[model samples]
Target: MKLLIVTPHFYPENFKVNDMAFELQKRGHDVSVMTAIPDYPEGRFYKGYGIFKKRRESINGVKVHRSLIIPRHSGSSFWLAMNYLSYTFFASLKSLWFGIAKKYDAIIVHEPSPILVGIPAVIIKKLQKIPVHFWVLDLWPESLTAAGGITNKNIIYPFEKLTKWIYDNCTTLMIGSKGYEKSICNKGDFKDKIEFFPNWVEDSLESQKMIDVPKLPKGFNVVIAGNMGDAQDLPHIMETARMLKGSNIRFNFIGDGRKREYVENYARENGLMNNIFCLGRYPLEAMPAFFAQADILFMALKDTPIFALTVPSRLQAYMSSGKPVVAMINGEGADTIREADCGWSVPAGDSEQLANLLKHLSTLNKDELTQKGANGKEYSRKYYDFTKCINHLEKIIGTGL
Candidate 1:
């Protein structure tokens, strides 16, 4: 199968779509990616990427075409809007031209957010009369209201319409969470087209050599990896840390995002520095090493209906690391921890419950904690296997052998 993946992010930006495109290419399919200049959590173009620099490159065997986009400087609402709109405008134009020059059997839109990425795939689909598979990793309008804090319907209505149009035009909708089905169906009659296509643990994470990180403080370490953003509910995590102060538990944050500075300041100002350690972001390959030193893997999301439906990608990574999980999250993510019997979960933003759970977990012996970790590893293998997921994707895109 000849496939083209249209996404707002790609390699050098650290998204799951990178793994999907590479895996498809590895499976005897010709896969190419259309993306923007690498700028993400840092909110600035990567050191060597820009409009005129390295616009076209190849990674492994997959061809990559990058479109010019405004960097999300400071990740403020204004800058983020510019970043999203720039990609939609430039990628759409690129799609029209690229669609004419290149032939592809199907176009996969790797939509993590700003459903507008589908505009380009929809354009190419119209030009070539081919299938457009939209992998919906985040819900629109709801994310704006939930995470972005945009409440005015007058402002959100347009995005809601755009979201529906994108959903209506796509040949297939691959939802990252089953909880999203109801939301997509509410937008339109997409019931027949919707498929549950959850994120898988990266194969690299499964086999990592432990590398030394900043010496962790002596105690039961709770490693919180991934983006520290509004959606992550960092405020409550800090509150939990404060409540657990003077205990053996320590919260180690291992990622950077919009709220990273705020988290750092909160820890310092409140004198919670001893209980919290902001280890900062590290390369993806180095995460398992950090996980190796953790007594528990912590994850959380703000208590919003939209977030409740989200099964954060980090959850799969943590479970795959063969570590006990502790989540201050609701809905799907919380349910997964319970179903796997991997660890404990508390309501999102509930510092009291979270602190209490950590206290109890600290009391558990090494063997008991290891059992929970083992349960998660087994469950991840059974349900979130990467090979099985890619196989399902092949069938969805009509490329199944």
Candidate 2:
């Protein structure tokens, strides 16, 4: 099958769609990606990419088409809107031309947020008369209010309409979290079209050779890997670190994003540097080694309706790393922690509870922690296996529409 994947983020930016495209191509399906220039967590285009330079390239046998987009400078809401809108407009224009020139059996919209990415796929579907399979990893209008902090009805109503139009056009809607079904269905009668398709841990993360990261402080290391964005509830995590000051527990943040500077600043100002360590971002291949040194893997999400329904992609990676997890999250994410019995979870934004949980985890014997980690790994293998997920995705694309 010839498949075209439409996404905002792809290779060189570190997104799950990169793995999906590679796996699809490996499986003999011709896969091409349509994406914007690489400017994600840092909110700037990557060193080697720009509007005119390297716009079209092939990576690992998959053809990639880059579109023009405003970088999300400072990751402010206004800039984020521009970044999303620019890609939607330019990519939709590209889709019209690409749809005619290149024939594909299906188009998959790998939407993590800014659901407008689906607009281009819809355009291609209209032009080529092919199925548009939308894999929704984030909910719109809700994310605007939840993550972007946009509250005005006048601001949200148009996006709500846009979200519905995109959903209505898709031949199939693959939801990342089962909890998303209710919200997506409320937007339209998509009950029949919705399919539960959760994220799998990246292949790189699953089988990486461990190398030492000497920067990690020697203590009860609580590693938080991945994006340190607003949705992560970094304030609560920092507060929890503050509460744990003077203890042997050391908080190691091993990723970067919009709030990374804020977290660094907060640690310095609050004099919590002793308990907290900001290790910045590393490539996906480096995660296992970091996970290897972690006493406990930590994750958190803000207290919001959208977040409560979200099962973060990091959760699967954390579990797959064979690390006992600790999360300050609500709803579906919290439920997964409990269901997997891999770790403990407290209510989102509850620093006191998280601090207490971390303290308790520190007291647990190595054997006990090891068992929890083992449980998580076993569960992840059963449910979040990459091969199984890709097989399911192929089946969905084959039969959808």
Candidate 3:
């Protein structure tokens, strides 16, 4: 099988696309990625990446084609638009000029963002008559408003239409959460073909090396990994840490995002710096051991209806680490944690209840924590294994593997 995985975010940016591409390549499919320069979470271009010079290279047996992009986004909504539009626009041109020319049995557009990333896939689908599956990670229009990226419905009208076109045109739509499925279908016409496809941790994460791992500062660590955006309500987290001032629990935040400054500043100014360790971002591979070092894994989201459907990719990572979770979110994500008996959960934005849960967790003995962690790992194995996930995805894609 020959596969073309299209995405704006890929290697060096730590998107799930990396794991999927490698899986396809490992399975004997000639997989090639069409992506722009890496600039995400951090906003600026990474080392060895540039705006102009287009390049192609082989990464771990998979061929990768890079395209030019306006690499300035991450923090502000203005730059966020530039980041999305710039990648979609140029990458579309790149597809027409180069990417679409390749012979591909199937096209898989891995859209963790910007529905427009599927533009190239649409062109390839129409021109070559190949099937293109759009794996939508986030719902547009609603997400734009949720992220405070775009609020004006008048200005968002065209984008709304665009979203409908993309949804209607794709061969199949894959959504990670039932929340996304319900919301997306309500917006337009996609109720028939949509399938549930939660993101899974790569099978490789199970083999985290035991030695020479990254060290934590001190205290019982309750770590939250992944993006630190406003959607996360990180200020609330800072306040949670503030409330737990004299406790043994230290809130450690890994990964970078727009509100990271707030996390740092609030921790420092409020005299809780030692209690809150903003360890920042690290590579995806390092996450297993890093998570294993923690006493409990943390998850939080804003008090939005859409976010209730949200489950961060890092949740899978945390589950894979076999650590008990302490979640502060609503809806499906919290339901999953509770169902798995993985850990405890309080409602989103409830600092007092959250503090109470942490206190209760602290009272639990080591053996109890270990059992909860084991349950989470077992649940992850049954549900969050990429091997099983991709098997289902390939069937839905109907590429005839």
Which should have the higher TM-score, number 1 or number 2?
1
lDDT of 3 by residue, 155-236 (tens): 7888788888888778788888877888888777788868888899875567756535568877788888888888887867
Candidate 3 local distance difference test against the native: 0.81
Worst 10 residues of 1 by lDDT: 207-216
What is the number of backbone collisions in each predicted candidate, taken in the order shown? 0, 0, 0
Candidate 3 or 2, higher TM-score: 2
For 232-275, candidate 2 gives per-residue lDDT tens digits of 99988888889988899998889888888899899899988888
Best by lDDT: 1
lDDT of 2 at 279: 86
lDDT of each: 0.90, 0.90, 0.81
Candidate 2 local lDDT, residue 108: 92
The candidate that achieves the highest TM-score relative to the unseen native structure: 1
Taking every candidate in turn, the Cα RMSD to the unseen true structure, in Å, is: 1.1, 1.5, 1.9
Which residue pairs of candidate 2 clash? Answer: none
Give the Cα-based TM-score of candidate 1 against the true structure.
0.98
